[model samples]
Structures are given as structure tokens and as C-alpha cells.
Target: MLRTLYRALWWLAAPAAVTRLLLRSRQERGYREHIAERFGCTAGRPLDDHAPLIWVHAVSVGETRAAQPLIEALLQARPDARVLLTHMTPGGRATGEQIFGERVLRSYLPYDVPHAVRRFLRAWRPTLGLVMETEVWPTLIEECQRRGVPLVLTNARMSARSFRRASRFGAATREVFGGFSRVLAQSPADAERLLALGARNVTVLGNLKFDMNTPAEQVAQGHAWRAAFGARPVWVAASTREGEEEQVLQAFAALNVARALLILVPRHPQRFAEVAALVARHRLRCERRSSWAVDGAVAGTAEKLDEDVQVWLGDSMGELGAYYAAADIAFIGGSLLPFGGQNLIEACAVGVPVLIGPHVFNFTQATADAVAAGAVLQVQDAAELARTLQTLFSDKPQRTAMGAAAAAFAARHRGATARTVEVLLTLLP
Candidate 1:
């Protein structure tokens, strides 16, 4: 009865959804491309519905990247488990498609309406489902449970605010989480938070982000980057969140930005253009990596050749590994401002010293550990951040020592992929 009514509501709202999409079509052509690409609703061979698939859904590029190590593990562990990867955002879907390619079926998760969920389940007939991080779709969870599709929430975390909201409707939320077969969370605090949210049979599984295996290309690129500006000294303002790029620019100004190139990769790719515009507005020359084609392969040879270029805007998607290879000192963004810090694991994985600013509630444990290990330096403001960057530029030995500590910290946290795979395999018949 619930599913029946939910589908009806979806149908009624369909017109509005269509209209909104049409109005934004020009502005968001990639999204339209995504829907066309995903649904086969635009006239290609339809997505196969007969296979018994393993469905995994992630929110965006960040979560999807975090889930990559696990996805690779699952594919290796179960050769027979045909994967179905779904994402809510167009960019997420794009990243998913690029990463998994034809090995995984791609789709936009239907709106959380009951009929959509029912249609999705009935069509895919997945053997098991994995929702990464906090992708809790109550209706979808309930439907999967009712249909006997085993569900697991992996690498889960819940902020205090999210916990409080779930607690207020504890009974309802509990009912939702009860549908999950198990929850493998990132930390004890996360496990406790999920338990509070009525999530069932949760266990502490350290964050998979830390377990990421760096590609050899990344290592090679890092060496190349070091050859280019490694001695010249550079500090990367990586994964900067909105409003934080300007702050990074301000930091560059306090010292001598001319001497150091600020490599700012926006946490969200959509802001790539916006950040480029901001850099231009500040009257600074910028080089976009996505557009650059260098002569003779050299460390940032394509970009740094433009000596007037102040900000190297990493507008490209799916290239963090390469960018991390191209840095000396790194600042993980979303921390400088109030947006909760971006993950520091990737930077750490590359053996680059890390620096962060206030606000890292999302990664409470990892940040705390990084700070204590002397693997990552935490600063309070843009002024301090500038001074810190300047100091690192002047001090090579300290930078090298910090980089080693960062790599060690990253090494200690591996194996979450294997552990997660173990838990996932248990769900199989």
C-alpha cells in the first residue's frame, strides 16, 4: 500500500520535474547528457534487467572516489557479482561511469518515491545493495528489505546534527535503518551515532579513504612535479571549498604569490569555472590544467612555464592523483571555512605534508590523528596559513620529515578495503 501511494505521488510530480529540467537544459547540458546516457531512455540498447547485480550508490565525486578502493575490492572478490553503480548527481554519475566504465551498469537513482524504488528494484533484481557513507534513502531501504534484497551501509558516518535530527524521529528512522542487514562505520563515534539513529548491527570499520592504493602513475607524476618545482618550493591550496579560494589568494598575497604557484582544485568541479573567474577578477594570471597541453613532458611543464600564472586551477575531474603528485605542501580544503574539511587521506597517501584550517567535524578522528602524528599541520586563519606556507617553503628538511610522517600515517590506515569486502561477501547466499 505504501509503495502504491508513493508511485502515485511521483507520477503527479513528474510534470514539474520535467519542466524544471527543460528550463535548466542549456545551463546544465552535462546533466541532460547524463540522463540520456544513463536511462537508455534516450534510445540506446537498454540497461540489462535480467542480471543478478550488486548495486552500489554514492552521492558525488568525493564519496564516489572514496568508494573506489572498495569497488575494486568487491569486483576482485566476486567475479560473478555484476555491479550496478548509481549516483544522485550528474557529476557523480559521470565520475562513476568514468571509473567503472562498462564493467558496472550506470543509472540515476529514481526519485525516492515508492513506485520509483519499486520499479528500480523490480527492474534490476540486485542480489545485494551497498549504500556508501550516509546515503540513507528510507523508502528505498524499506522496499529493498521487503523484497528480501540484503542491504549494507559501508564506511558510514553521521554528524552530531544529523544524529540529533534522526533521534528526534527515532522510531521512524529506526524503522528505516532496521531494513539494513549491517552497517560498517568509520569510527566508534560513527558506530555509536548510527546506533543512535536506529541503524542495526553496526560495526566499527576504519575509513576506507585511508586505505586507498595510490596508482604508480601518481608516483611517477609526483617525481616529475618534484623535478619541476620540487626545489623551487610550492604549497598547494588543494580541494578548496567555496569562498576558501579567495582566502587562499589572500594568503598568497601576504607572502609572495609570484614565487609560489597556488594550485587550487575546487572540492566541487562545478565551481571550477567560478574559481577561474575569481582568480581572473583578482587580476592574477591563471593557467587551467584541463586546457593546458605542455611541450615536452616536464613537471608542471605545461603550467609553470607561464611564469605570470599565479593560480593553477585544477578544473579537470578524475585527476586528483595526478594533482597530488604535483604538489609540495598541501592544504586540504573545506576546513578553512565552515564547510567541514575535505578528506586528507589522498594527500597523505602521496607523502606530502598536509595543512588544514578550522572546521573538520566530518573527519573528526582522521583530522585528530593527523594532528597528533605531526603528519598534518592545522592553522587557524588565512594569515597563519600564509605564514605556514612561507615557512615550509624556507624549510626543506622539516617538509621532508613531515611528508614521511604523513605517508606513515596513511600506511597505518590501509586494509579497510579488505575488511569491507569480507563483510560484504557474508551477505551472499
Candidate 2:
């Protein structure tokens, strides 16, 4: 009865959902391109019958990037298997294309209405399904189960805040979680929460982000960029959400380090222009990453900027590793307010000393573990963040030690991909 009502609500909201997508498309044109696919009107080349089709739903960029190692492992394990990647956001689809290229098929997953879900399932007929992170669709789960398709919630995490919210949904939440064939959690705390939510066959396989190996080319590019930066204390504010950037820019404006470069990378691509304008409003001289050129060619080896350029706006996509690699210190954003924290692990993986805000319930375990390892430091607000940055910039030895620890902390958390693949293959037909 609950599932029926949930389906009814989604059906009723379909018009609004379409309108929202159209509104978003004004900022990001890609959102408008795949409108039909979102409504389950996906018509593409027929699937290869001989090869097993594996469907993986990664809602956006973060999930899509985290699924990289697992997806690669799956293809390696089952050479003939065809991996079908589905996403709801254009950024995620673009990231999938940038990372996987021709390796995996990409499509926008339909909205969670019964008819759309049925059409999507019928079109793909995936032998197995893996939903990344915390996405739980009741109608889709029910449909997958009804079709006898084994669905797994891979790299699952449930923050306390999220748990409390899900708990409010009562049996409806449990029904969705319980529908998964298996729940591969990121940590013991996550596993415990999933169990409470009635998820069955749950296993703690760590985080796939830990298993992600930074692209070698990106690392080299970062090194080149750092060399170009030439002793300027470079710090990256990576994957910052809305409202957080204003605080960060204000902090950057107050920071005392002379000729220091602040690489501000907003989490969303649509906000690139807005962030640039924000930097301008601070009266800080800013040079955009996209505008950086080497001898008239754009996006090549970084050219040295004028000493007056206080902020380097990272407006490009798929080059986060390079940005982290180019930085002396990294601040993981999204934690300043109440949006939880962005991934600090990525910065740590690049061997950079990290700082985060007080709010990190989304990455509670990872933040705790990183802090325990001396790889990360927590600050209460923007003022403290600026103070910490000033102190860290002056203390080179402490920064070096923290960088080493960050690398070690990242190295210690590897192998989740292998474990995830092992479990996933067991469920494959």
C-alpha cells in the first residue's frame, strides 16, 4: 500500500519534475538534451545478447567517479560483460564519458514512476543492477525485484542526520532498503545503520573512493602547474557548494599570505560564472583556469600568472586531481554550513594537508579516521579556517608531516574495489 502511494505521488509530480529540469537546462544545456531519456523514452542500439548486461545507476558526479574502480574491476573480472551506466545529471553523464570513454554505455535513468521504471528495465534487461551510494527508489527497487533482477546498493553510507530523516518515513524507507539483494556499506557504522533500516545481506566493503587511483596524466599535469606556480603558497578550495564559496572568498580576502594563490573550484559547473563574479566582488584579482593559456593555446601547461592574481578560478571539469596535485594545502568544502562535507579523501589521495569545517556528518567516519591519522584538521568557521591556513603556511615542517600522513591515510584504505567486485560477481547470473 505504501509503495502504491509512493508511485502515485511520483506520477503526480512528473510535470513538476519536467519543469524543474527545463529550468535547470537554462544554466546547463546538457540537462535539456536528454529529456526523453529521463522519462524512460530511451531508444538506442540493442544490447548484445551473448554478453551479460550489468546496469549501474550513479546519480551524479561523485557517485559516478566513486564507481570508477568498481566498474573497471567488473569489466576485468567478466571480460565479455557489458556495463550500462545510468545517471540523472548531465555532469555525471559527462564525467562517465570523460572517464570511461567507450568502455561503458551511458543513459539517463528514468524517473521513479512505475511505467518509466518498467520501460527502462524492459529496455536494458540488465542481468544485475548496482545502485551507488544512498539512492533508494521504491518503485524501481520493487520493479527490479519483481523481475527477479538482483539489485545491490554498493558503497552504501547513512549519516546520522540522514538516518533520522529516513527513520521518519517508517516502513516506506525500510521497504526500499530491504528490496536490495545486498547492501555493500562503506563502514561498520554505515552497515549498522543499513541493518536498522531493514537492509538484508549487508556487508562492509570500505569505500570505493579509497580505491580510486588518481590519473597519472592528471598528477603530472598538477606537478607542471605547481612548478609554474613557483613557490606561491597554493591552496585549493575543492568541490565547494553554494553559500560556502562566499565565506571562502571572504576568508581568502582576509588571508595575509603575500602572492598566495587561492584555487577556488566550485562543486557545480553551472555556478562557475557565478563564482567568478563572486571573486570579482571581493576585489581580488582572479584568473580562471579555463582562460589560462600557453602561447595562445588554452588548457595547456599552466602559464605563470601575474603576481597580482589572488585567486585562480578552477572552472574546468574532470581536472580535480590536477587541481589538488597543484596545491600546497587543500580545503574540502560543503561542511561550512549544513550540507555535510565534500570528499576530503581526494585531496588526501593527492598527498596534500587537508582542512574541513565542523559539519561533516556525511563523512563522519572518514573525517574521524583522517583526523586520527593526522591527515586532516577541523575548523569551526571561516575565521578559524583562515587562521589555520595562515599558521599552516608559515609552518612548512608541519605541512610536510601532514602531507605524508594524508598520503599514508589514503594508501591504508585501498582494496574496496576488489572486495566489491568479488561480492558483485557472486550475484551475477
Candidate 3:
């Protein structure tokens, strides 16, 4: 009865959900493009009889990138298998196009209404379902189970706060989570949480984000960008969120370090203009990557700025590795403002020393491991962050040591992708 009520509530919210999508379309136009796919009107895609169709749902850019290694492994191991990738956000869809091209079928995952879910299942007929990190929808799980489609939640994690909220629903939460055939957790704590939430067959398979490699081309591009800047004391504040940018800018200004450059990459593309305006409000000259030359030179003489640009706004998409590569030190943002945190693993992968603020509950295990490994530094707030950067800037040896430790730390956490794929193989027919 509770399940039926929940479904009815979702049905009633359909109009509001569409309205939300239309509002979001103002910032990212892809939200308006695939209305039919969101309703499960996907058709005309050929299915291979010999090869099984495996569906993977990665809701946004972060999960989409995290699933890359797994997707590649599936295609490599099962030569006959066809992969269908679905996402809830336009950025994820655009990223899918950039990364996978026509190799996999791409679509917006239908809203979790029974009609839409049924239409989706009938259209795709996937042999198994792999959902990335904590995207459990009751109706989707129920429909998948009814259709006899085995579902696995990979890189799964439940925060203490999230667990408490789920506890409110009592048996319904348990029923939803319990329906999964398996849950591959990111850590032991996550496994415990999942078990308490009524999940069965849980395994601690580590984090898939750890297994994703920084592309070689992106690394080379980083070198080019560094060359463009030429010997400026460069640092990156990556995946920064709003309200945090003003903090970052203030922290950077406090340092007052001469000839220093900050590469600020906001978390969302829609916020690029807003961030640029923030930079102006702070009286800092900046360069937006979108306006910056793609093939031309850095527009200045060697080891000198043409106009003393203080910040390089990373407004373009799909080049995070380059940003990480081009920096001497990295500050993982979103942590400063109780926004959980952004992934710091990419910085570690590229051998850059990292700093993160106090609130990193979203990536608890990873942050703890990185801190223990001497791969990252934690600061109390923007003020301490500025002090730490200044201290590190004055101490080259400490920075070098931290960077080496970061690279080693990332290397030690690999093999999760292989383990995840091994479990996935068992679920496939």
C-alpha cells in the first residue's frame, strides 16, 4: 500500500518535474532536446541477438566519468555485448557523446513512473542493470525485479545523514534497497550501512573513481597550458561551488603572492558567467577559457603575463585532467561550504598535491585514506587554506614530497574496476 502511494505521489508530481526540466533548459539546452527519451520513447536502436545488452545508469558527469573504466572493461571482455548508457543530466549526456561517441546507445533515463519504467524496460531489454553510486528509486527497483532483471548498485555508499533520512520510511526503504541483487560498496562502513538498510549480498569493492585514469592527451595539454603561463606560481581550485568562490578569491588575495595564478574551475557550466562576474567584483583580472585561444599562443612573452591575469576561469568542459595537470597544487572545493565535497582523486592521480576543507563527508573514506597516505592536506577554513598555500609555496621540497605520495596513493587503490567487472560478469546471461 505504501509503495502504491509513493507511485501515486510521483505520478502527481509529473507536471512539476517537467516544469523543473524546462527551467533547467535555460542554462543547459540539452534538457529541452530529448523530451521523448525522458518519457521512454526510445526506439530504432538495433539490438544484437548474440551479444547481451548491458544497461548502466550514471546520473551526471561525475558518475558518468567514474563508470568509464567499467564500461571499457565490459566492452573489452564481452566482445558480443552492447552497452546502453543513460543519465539524468544534460552534462552527463554531453560527456557521454564526447567520451563514448557512437560506441554506446545514449538516452535520458525515463522518470520512475511505472508507465515510463515499463516502457524503458521493454525497449532496452537489458540483461542486467548497473546503477552508479546511491541512485536507488523504489519504482525502478520494483519494475526491474518484476521483469526478472538483476540489478547491481556499484560504488554504493550511504552517508550517516542519508541513512537517517531513509530510516524514516522504515520498511519501504528496506524493501527498495533489499530488492537489489547485489550492492558493491566503496568501503567497509558503506557495507555496514547498506546491511543495516536491509541490503543483502553486499561486497566492499572499493571506489570506481580510483580506477579511472587521467588521459595522456589531457596531460600533454596541461603541459601546454603551463607553458602558456610560464613559471607563475600556479594552483587550481577545482570543482568549486557557489558561495565558495568568493571565499577562494578572498583567500587567494590574502596570500598577496606576486606573479601567482589561480585556475578556478566552477563545478557547473551554467555558473561560468556568474563566477566571472564574481571575479570582477573582487577586482581581479581573469581569462575565461571559452574566450581564450585554442590554437594560438598564450599571448605574452616567455615567463611573463601580457596583462597580469590573476585567474584563468576554466569555463570549458571535459578537460579536468588538463586543469589538474597544469597546477603545482590543488584545492578541492565544495568542501568549504558544507556542500559535501568534490572528487580529489583526479588530482592525486595526476601527482598534484591537494588541499580540502573540513566538510568532506560525501567522500569520507577516500579523504581519510588520502590524508593518511600524506597525499592531501586538510584546512579549517579559507583563512587556514591561504596560510597552508603560502607555507607550501615557500617550501618546494614539501610540495614535491606530497605530490609523489599522491601518485603512489592513487596507484595503490587500483584494481576496483576489475573486481566490479568480475561481479558484473556473473549477472550477465
lDDT (Cα atoms) of all candidates against the true structure = 0.79, 0.90, 0.90
Best by TM-score: 2
Tell me the tens digit of each residue's lDDT in model 2 across 1-429.
776787788889999998988899898989888788887888744865657889999999989999998999899999889999999999999999999999998899999988888888888888999999888888889999999999999999999999999898888888888999999999999999999998999999999999888888888888877777777899999999999999998788778998889999999999999999988888888998888863312233568777788888999888899899989999999999888898888889999999999999999999999999999999999999999999999999999999999999999999999999999889887
Q: Tell me how many residue pairs clash in candidate 3.
A: 0
The local distance difference test score of model 3 is: 0.90
Query: Can you give the lDDT of residue 140 in candidate 1?
Result: 82
TM-score of each prediction: 0.90, 0.97, 0.96
Full-model lDDT, candidate 1: 0.79
| Better TM-score candidate (2, 3) | 2
Q: Rank the candidates by TM-score, best first.
A: 2, 3, 1
lDDT digits (tens) for residues 19-119 of candidate 3: 98899889878788888888788882556454588999999999999999999999999978899999999999989889999999888999989889989
Candidates 1 and 2 compared: the better one by lDDT is: 2
For candidate 1, write residues 1-429 as lDDT tens digits. Answer: 544565677678766776766666554565554543232232222476444578888878888888888888888888877888878777788888887888877777777766567777766778899999888877788888899999999899887767887787656778777779999999999998888777888999899998776677656665565455434556677778888988988988897534677778887766778899999988988888777663324445533345566677887777777677778889989998988788898988888999999888788889999988889999999999989888888788999999999999999988888888988888876
Which regions of candidate 3 deviate over 4 angstroms? 44-50, 296-307
